[model samples]
Each structure stands twice: as structure tokens, then as C-alpha cells.
Target: MLDIRRLHMLKTVAARGSITAAAQSLALSAGAVSQQLAALRHDVGVDLLRPDGRTVALTEAGRVLLEHADRILAAMEEAECAVAAVKGTVGATATLAALPSTVARIVAPALTALGTDHPQLAVTCLVTDQAQLRELTLGTVDVVLGQRYHHVPETMPKGIAVSPLLDDPLLVVTAADGSDERSFGLRELATHHLVVPPATTDCGQAILHACRQAGFTPTTRYVTADIAAQLALARSGLATALVPRTAIDPATPGISAAPIEDHPIQRLLFAATRRTETTNPTTAAVIAALGTAARQDHTTYLPPA
Candidate 1:
């Protein structure tokens, strides 16, 4: 019989491209990982990995076994879900991964509600800049809160199901002057020194595309991934900034925000989970709690029409 744990280790090695990297990810020593792989190879009676300069490549046999391993692991998850359904309890540990902004604005409240409603379900949240989609496939995280910008098209991975949560509109933030907020056209941004996220980020790329579409490039005075820093620059009158509505706290002093009237840019926020695990009571509870929290905070976001 094939060892399920060894099969999982093989998948991790394949994903990481090296035994050492996989060992680090799994929190195991390289020698321990090597020993498990050797045992798996002996039991399977085939070479599963071949070293390719500085890394290991999966052999043809390894690829075949990987396919089976995926199915086996998925089936195991389904079995667990079914058992949980019968038990009628959400008593399981689940990890959720999301961007920093989402964690603060949406996930925090959702987790609080989840804790109150389902005390038996324990969840841990990991704050990340990127979605870490591969971690979902590896079963390292049970769910992910992700965003899709209007200008950037993202293809969801196979076996992952995404459910829309809200549409977060980008706003122009400037230092407050005690005047009524008024919308600004994209063309108006050409004259102001701007603070923006790095061009390599999804939000940055979308903002850049929107600016160019308005026929003039923005004069970016500051480039930073930290939304707080961007807002700080705007608050200090150093530069104006484009920020997602969710990243702004309405009560924050010194900064005023208004939507871009002529050309609106928004990012769709969604939650992603393994298709097979959706039926799990704990996963279902978490998704529901997030939805509830989002609706409660809907006044801050622009819902998709």
C-alpha cells in the first residue's frame, strides 16, 4: 500500500522543485524528507525523481503517481467533509489566507462573528500580499480572500471555486480642506504629484492602465506597496493617492476621498476554496460569516449592479 503522507511529500517536492525547499515548507529536515522519498521509491519500484542541475525534476513515473495522489487526497477530503456533515458540527481547524487590507477590513469582523456563532470551529488567518493560491491546492490553507482588478484578468486555478464578495472602488485621496467632497476626472490627475503602489502589483498595474487610458501618464512622486504609506503621503499634502475604498477608514482625519467620476476603476473581492471542500461544515460556516460581515459593511463598498 502507498503511504499517503509520502505521496503528499512527493507533491510538495514537485511543487517546490527541490527536496530542500519542500523540506523547509513542510518543516522537516532534508534527510527526513529524503528518507521518505526513498521509501516511497522502493515501494513503488520506480524512479520518481531525477536531479536536474540544482533541482529535481519529476520523472514520468512521478507524474503518473502525482495524478493519482491528487485524486486520492481529494477523495480523502471529501470523506472528511461527509463525516463532518453527519456529525453536524463545525469542529475543525481551518487556515485562511488573505491580503493585509482584506484581513483588517473584512476578515477580522467575519472571524469575530464566526467565533461567536461556531465556538467549536477554530480558524487562523495569514496576512499576505499575494493570494498564495498554490497553498490552497497544497491544502495548506482552507480558503483565500482575493481581489481581481478591472484592468487585470486573472484565471482561477482548476478545482478552485470563487464567490464574489464586493466591489471595492478606487478613490482619489487628497489632504482635507474642510470643503465638500467632489468627484474628479482622470485627466485632472495629470497635474498632481501622485503616490501609487508599485507598477508590478495588480492594483498598481490597473491604476497605471487607467491613467494612460486618460491620455497622460501620472507623475508618480512615491511608489510603495503599503496603503498606509500612500494615505500618509496624501494626508501630509506631499502627494495625492489612488486607493481602494476598503483600505480607507472613513473616520481617519486629514485625508479626503472622492470617486473618479468619468473613469471608474474597481476591484472585485472574492473568496476562493477547494470545490470539494465547500461542503465541509467549517468551510461553509466561514464563507457564510464572511458574506454576512461584507453585507454589514456594504455601505462602505459599491456593490456590483
Candidate 2:
């Protein structure tokens, strides 16, 4: 009979792209992982991996087995969840990974509500900007709160399920001291020093693309990855910034905000989970809490124009 644990190791190795990386994710030694794979290969009577430079590539047999492994693992998890459901308790631990901005406004509140509603289930939240889906496949996180710009292409990896949470509009932020009364368009911001996120980020790229489409490049004097910092600079009369509505508190003093008139842009916030864990009661409960938190009114912005 095949070992379920070995199958999981193979899946992790495939997801991580290298045995060493997979070992690191699994918190096991490379030699130990190799031994397990060797034993697995012996049982299957075939080579499952081939060296492709520094990384290992799955063989034809490995690919075929991986497909089966995915289904098997998912079914096993579903079975466990079913058993727990029958017991009248969902006593499980789940980890949630989310972006920093979403952590404060959405994740925090959702966690609070989740704790109140489901006392038996425990959840841990991780803030990250790296590869969230890869982490999900590696079992490092149970749920992911991620965002994508409207202009960017959506690439959903296999075996992951995504659900939309909210549409976060990008708004023009400036000082509230009533020094600037100009109706702001993407092009109009060329005259003022701008504060924007790093160009490498999706939000930054989208904002830059919108500005270039408006026939002028912004004179960016301040570049930061934090939306709060961007707002602070705008509030202090140092620069103007384009910030997401979810990150901005409408009542924040000394900051004026208005939606972009010429070229409107917004990012879609979504929650992702492994397809295998979708039926798990804990995962469902966390997603439900996130949905509830996202439904709150974070769109209210002061009309500063």
C-alpha cells in the first residue's frame, strides 16, 4: 500500500520546485525527504523526479501520481471534516494570510468576530506580500486575503479557489487646509509632487499606467509602500497621493480625499483557500467571517474637491 504521508511530501516538493525548498517548508532535512522519496519510488517501481539544473522536475509518472495525490489528500481532509462535523464540534486550528492593509481593517475585525462566534476554532493571521498561493499549497496557511489591480491579468493557480471580497477604489489624497481647490484629474497631478507606492508593486504599476495614459508623468517626490505613509505625506502638505479606500479612514483629520475623475481605478480584494480545505468547517467559518467584515462601509471618503 502507498503511504499518504509520502504522497504529501511529493506534492510539497512539486509545489516548492526543489527538494531542498520542500524540506525547508516541511521542517525536515533534505536527506530525510530524499529517503522518503526513495522509499516511495521503490514501492511504485519507477523514478518520480529528474534533476533539472538545481531544481527537480516531475517525471511523467510523477505528474500522474501528483494528480491522484491531490484528489486523495482533498478527500482525506473532507473525510476528517465530515467526522468532526458529526461530532458537533469544529475543533481545529487555521492560519490566515493577508496583506498588511487588509490586516488592520478587515482581518482584525474578522478575527474578533470569528473568536466570538466559534470559540472552539483557533486561527492565526500572517501578514505577507510574497507568494500566497504557494504558501497555501505548502500548507503554511489555510486562507489568503489578496488583492489584484483591475488592469492586471488574473492568474489563478490550479487547486486554489478564490472569492471576491470587495472593490477598493483608489482616491486622490491632499491636504485639508483648503490650500488646493483644483478639481483633480490624473493629468492635473503633474504640477504637484506625488507620493506613490513603489513602482514594483501592482498598485504602483496601475497608478503609473493610469498617469501615463493621461498624457503626463507624475513628479513623484515621495515613494513608499505603506498607504498610511502616503496619506501622512499628503496630510502634511508635502505631496499628493493616490490611496485605496480601504486603507483610508474617512474621518482622519488633515487629509482631503476625492475619487479620480479622469481615470478611475480600483483593486479587487479576494480571499483564497486551497480547494481541498474548502469543506473544512474551520476554513468555511474563517471565510464567512472575512466576508462579513468586508461588507462593512469602508468606502466613505471626505469630499475635499
Q: Give lDDT per model, in order.
A: 0.89, 0.85
lDDT of 1 by residue, 153-201 (tens): 7798888988889888899999998888789999999999999989999
lDDT of 2 at 54: 86
* Candidate 1: count of backbone clashes, pairs at least 3 residues apart or interchain: 0
lDDT digits (tens) for residues 159-195 of candidate 2: 7888899988888888896565445677788898999
The parts of candidate 2 lying over 4 Å away from their true place are 84-88, 179-183, 276-278, 299-305
Model 2 Cα shift for residue 66 (angstroms):
1.7
User: Best-fitting candidate, measured by TM-score?
Assistant: 1
TM-score of 2: 0.89
Question: Which portions of model 1 show Cα errors greater than 4 Å?
Answer: 300-305
| Cα TM-score per model | 0.96, 0.89
- Give candidate 2's error at residue 40 in angstroms: 1.1
